[model samples]
Target: MRLLALEASQNSTYYISRYQQVEEFGADLCVLNGEGTEGTWPEDRYRIVGSKHIDDIIAAARAWHAQQPFDGVLTFSEASVTAVAAVAEALGLPTIGFEAARTSRNKLLMRQAHEKGGAAHPDYRFVPELEDALRAGEEWGYPLVLKPTLGAASNFVFRIDSPDEMRERFPQAVDGIKDMAWFTMEADGLDLGPHGLIVESFLDGREFLIEALAWDDEVYLGSIVDRVTVEGDTFDDDVHHAPTSLTPDEVAAVHDVVRTGAWAQGVRRSALHAEVRFHQGRPYLLEIAVRPGGGGLDHMARVSAGYSPIEAVMNVARGVRPEVDHYTPTGVHTAAMCLISRAGRIQEITVPEEVSGSSQLFFFKVTAGPGDVIKRPPHGNNILGFLGATGTSFEDAMSTATELAAQIRVEFTD
Candidate 1:
């Protein structure tokens, strides 16, 4: 199938890997970007509209479609979700609808939709300023989550344990969101609805990341991974393991909640990245992103569960129901984590042959290069890349992953 992936306001470089995956899977892929670096893709297959505005993007896409029609339109970006929906609608192609796209992209809208649809979620208040955040903190009490309305990869997300921390972090979040690539990369001239901070009641329990698909009145959990991250004030450090340890009953409960949340977000037929966390021994919907999960999650899904989220994306874009079923593990054990380090400009990153050439290694990618700034929490949740390994058990997998991670050295410019 001929597919077109849209990157409205292409602010990040990681999307190239996703586009390449489409081609590697034997699909004819083309890219349309509102704003992108020159030569990021071949001239024959890439087009830039030169403006990050919705109108310009639609016009450019319409012109391109008239010349060479695309069988499907899609995106692998949190920022471009709504833009792709708009383009697909304009071109008379299959879409999850613009309303679903908007609600999925904005946290405040998502919470409101979930509440209206009776999906279990945390109480949230949109805070536009520090004063608003302070009032929210007072009302919601301490140990609340302060996050941006339009956010991804946990950027500008903080766990406020006290009012003083709320006071200290509110201004940083306000300043950081101004330049946050996730927010800034959105196509202009759309009513994004509450483009600011939100204070949410925290869920204190284990978290699960699910790669799922939503069909007509049904949702399928393709791959389920456990978020084994050690919690901190900021949520930058993420560690994951699979096959998940959820009991069959727990998995069914998670599936029901995910289905409810997906319908609540008006996502009827699309690839979903649902994040569910527990509170008081019950699952609550954290989010339902209208795209596949990031990092080596696609690889994890294939290896650990015998499910292919990338293939699901392609199928959904073409308006075809993906071949998916309820969560079923292939009895494979793997562990993965985001490569994080202290803040600085990257000078060199070295992965020793022992780690790189190991047979247990399944996934590795260096996202940062020389001269790239690596920002940790407070500034941003910048990552070096991803590393995943397989083993006989969860402990063995995690041990191999961590040990190999330690051997991969990163040098920063002082």
Candidate 2:
């Protein structure tokens, strides 16, 4: 089948990784972006690859449509929601609605919808000014999370437990975000995405995930994945167990929450990666990113759970019924651990031979070699790229990966 994929994250690595996944599954893929092309990506993989501007995606889509009559259109999280919807709408093809995309992209709107639907979420308020957040902080309590309404990889998400902390660090946050509404404003209309920010409680407890596949405005089924993080919050190092570590009851509860969230929002034509934390033994909605999750969440589902998120997403765009992984859970833990660097340029990257040689190590791949600068932002910075094994237990895989990662030395330009 042919898949028209949107790859305009403005982050090269994310697009490349996702593009690779789509191409691997025997689907013909096409690329559209906000900014123009990056390096050279083979046309064999992306048969219709180009740096088409936001307005130009349609023409490109039409050309492809006329030539090939694309079977489907696939896109990630919420960023490409509008473009995909517009493209699908233009083509008289099925797509996630503009309103639903808005609900998913903006955290304030998403949480408010949950509350309206009689679901539980942290107390939150969205305001254009910083002072209002401070006022809300007073009304609520300490230990709050302030973040962009539209973002991924937990970018600029901070947890403040005290007024003193807020006073000490609140002002620096007022820079370089262009949020209005997800669909109404584009870079040309008004920078509509992550410019808007919100503050909510730091919902404390163990975090888990539910991956849902939607068919004809219904979340047909879902899978449970457990989150394992080195740092307490996501901004720090984080990992995932493709299969969760929760009990059956817990998985059921989590999956129910996912269903509830999707049903409540009327999600159609997408994959949902939601974060749920237990509050008083019940699932409290952390945040729902209505797209396939980043950081091998897709791969985990493929390798550990026996499904491809990329292929499933393609099916959604094709208007075909999709299959989602079920609650018949797999391992105690099947981990996808990432080894990160604090900061520095890539002088050299060396993986331990023992770890690389192990049979358990399914895929060990690296991005950087020597003389590449490693930036602070972990999302786009490809210092030491990795794709390694799947172990019997999450803890074992994590510990082994961590131990081996220490030996990988990337000498910075510093």
Candidate 3:
């Protein structure tokens, strides 16, 4: 089988892992990378920044298919999901449909679709201007969450407690939209139109991520990941631990909510990433993505389970049902932590030998080095590196990972 991957990045360890898994399945991999990412994959390669134009992507795919037909068209990145779905539809291949892909990228559309499908979601309003946002504030009341309709990594996500705070922070939020618009405009079909924001009623609760694969309209529940976020002023992810701390019954309820959200988005065959908030014994859908979760999520899944989500997604792309036994705990716990640093030029980073040599350590990757400038949150790409570990229990795994993460000293220049 020949697989055509859209927008494969060499910088991603996850992408490289998935490529290796595909080859392990005896499938020939052909990558269509973005503008400067040409030499990432040594195999058959094509260059077309898929986000720039769907037609160009389809044209390139068609030309490639003429020589050797591709058995599957897929992508794992959030940026390229819609484009890949468009190409798959053009080729009469399996996909979640362009509408679903569009909805997945836009939070406003996602909330509307979920509500229409009888899936519980927060009350939201599409804010196209400051007036609209103010109106939404009046209707939704205080302590609302304001974010871009299409955004990732919690960039520009603000929690407005009152109209006064909204007035003060509204400009910054609008600026974020402008910054994001620069990229969204270049992406062929993803235009936010003037100004766009989603004001949602804030739900107070614990958050969890649902990782699953859907095939033949049946959702296979994978591990439910417990997400830890930075407290105060930002919603950036701090750590992820799996299998979840949720009880069996709670996990099942989360799974049902995920299934409903996935089906509502018309996701028949794809890797599903759903974020939900549990409040008062009820799970409310936060958002869903038709791509695999990032930050070594697949790695944690492999450590906690016996199978890889990357492999399962590949199987789904090839129209094969993934052999998955959901929520079957492996008697051990796994955790992944992001290496965050203060904003400045990195001078030196030291990882303790003891921590590095530990058997519990799964992998440690550093993306920043000397002279590399580090920015803080709202930039959404502030992570300096990542660390993963496994232990006899969730507490043990989390403690080990947290301690190891603390041992890595990152010195920044004055």
Candidate 4:
């Protein structure tokens, strides 16, 4: 099979793993990337210059397909999913369609679709201006959340506790929206005109993620991952563990809600990443992305569930249903911790022998070495590295990973 992959960065481990998986499946890969980002992939590279508009991308893809005649068009990156969907549809290939891809990226559209499809979601209002946001705050009450209509990695997401706080932080949130728009415009040439925000009631509950593979409108549950974030901080993710602490019944409940939300967004053949909050024995859909979860989620799934997310995605691209039934629980726990640091130039990184000697330590990687600049939070690229581990139990795995993370400290210059 000849597969056309759009926008796989050479520097990203996730993309590298994906490329390796495709080759492992004995497929020829062709990559399409933005102009300057060309030649990053080792496969047959095609360039789409300024204005990565959907029509332009499709046109370029059509020309490439005419010669090479690719069997599939696929992308794992969130920014390129919509473009891939359009190209796939244009080429008469299987995909989730353009509308579902658009709904997955736009929070406002997603909420509307979920509500219309009978999926429970938080009360939300689209605010085009500051005054509208203030009005929404009043109507939605305090402790609301403000975020961009189209965003990822919790960028520019703020939790407002009161009207006063909302007033004070409204400008910052607007700035975030503008920054996000500028990024999309530069990266994908996607002109997201003006700035808009979504204010929604904060759902107070335990957070969980459901990873699934969808085929023929049937969603197969892969694994339930419990998301651990810094308490009181809206953007900081501490860790993610697979085979969540939730009981079998609770997992089933979350699965039902996730299935509803996935179908509501028209996910037919894709990797589904759905986030839900469990409160008072009820599951509420938070958000859904038509891609696999990042931050070593694929590794977690493989370790705990005996299935590889990357392989599942590759199967989808190859016009085949993923072998979901082959996944069986291994009775082991896996966790991934994000190595974060403050803004500064790294002087040295110290990894203690105790941490390196631990039997539970699966792997440790430091992205920012000595002399590398590390930006603080709220910055788009802030992850210093990642640490992954496995244990007999979730608590043991998380505790060991946390202790190992604490030992490896980055010393910044004065």
Q: Could you say which candidate leads in lDDT? A: 1
Q: Estimate each model's TM-score.
A: 0.98, 0.86, 0.90, 0.88
Q: After superposition, how far is residue 413 of candidate 3 from its true place, in Å?
A: 4.9
Q: Which runs of model 1 end up more than 4 angstroms from their true locations? A: none
Worst 10 residues of 2 by lDDT: 178-187
Sorted by TM-score, highest first, which candidate order results? Answer: 1, 3, 4, 2
What TM-score does candidate 2 reach?
0.86
The whole-model lDDT of each prediction reads 0.91, 0.63, 0.75, 0.74
Candidate 2: pairs in clash: 143-161, 178-195, 179-195, 179-196, 345-412, 347-411, 362-389, 363-387, 367-385
Prediction-by-prediction clash tally = 0, 9, 0, 0
lDDT of 2 by residue, 1-414 (tens): 777776443444445767776778677776655554445366543433243344566766776688777777767735666567667777777777767776776777788778887666788888577787788788988778877777655555677777776664455444424321222223233234445668887766778766667665456335667666645323543566657667878776776676677656667557777788887788888766667766666666666666566677777777876766465544534555566676666666666677678666544556555776554432232335654456667668766666666666655667
Ranking of all candidate structures by their lDDT, best first = 1, 3, 4, 2
lDDT of 1 by residue, 304-327 (tens): 999888989998998989889888
Q: lDDT value for candidate 4?
A: 0.74
Candidate 4 colliding pairs: none
lDDT of 3 at 82: 75
Candidate 1, residue 137: the lDDT equals 74
**Candidate 4, 154-221: lDDT as tens digits:** 76777888778777777776766566632463235333332378888888888987678777756777
- Return the TM-score for candidate 4, rounded to 2 decimals: 0.88
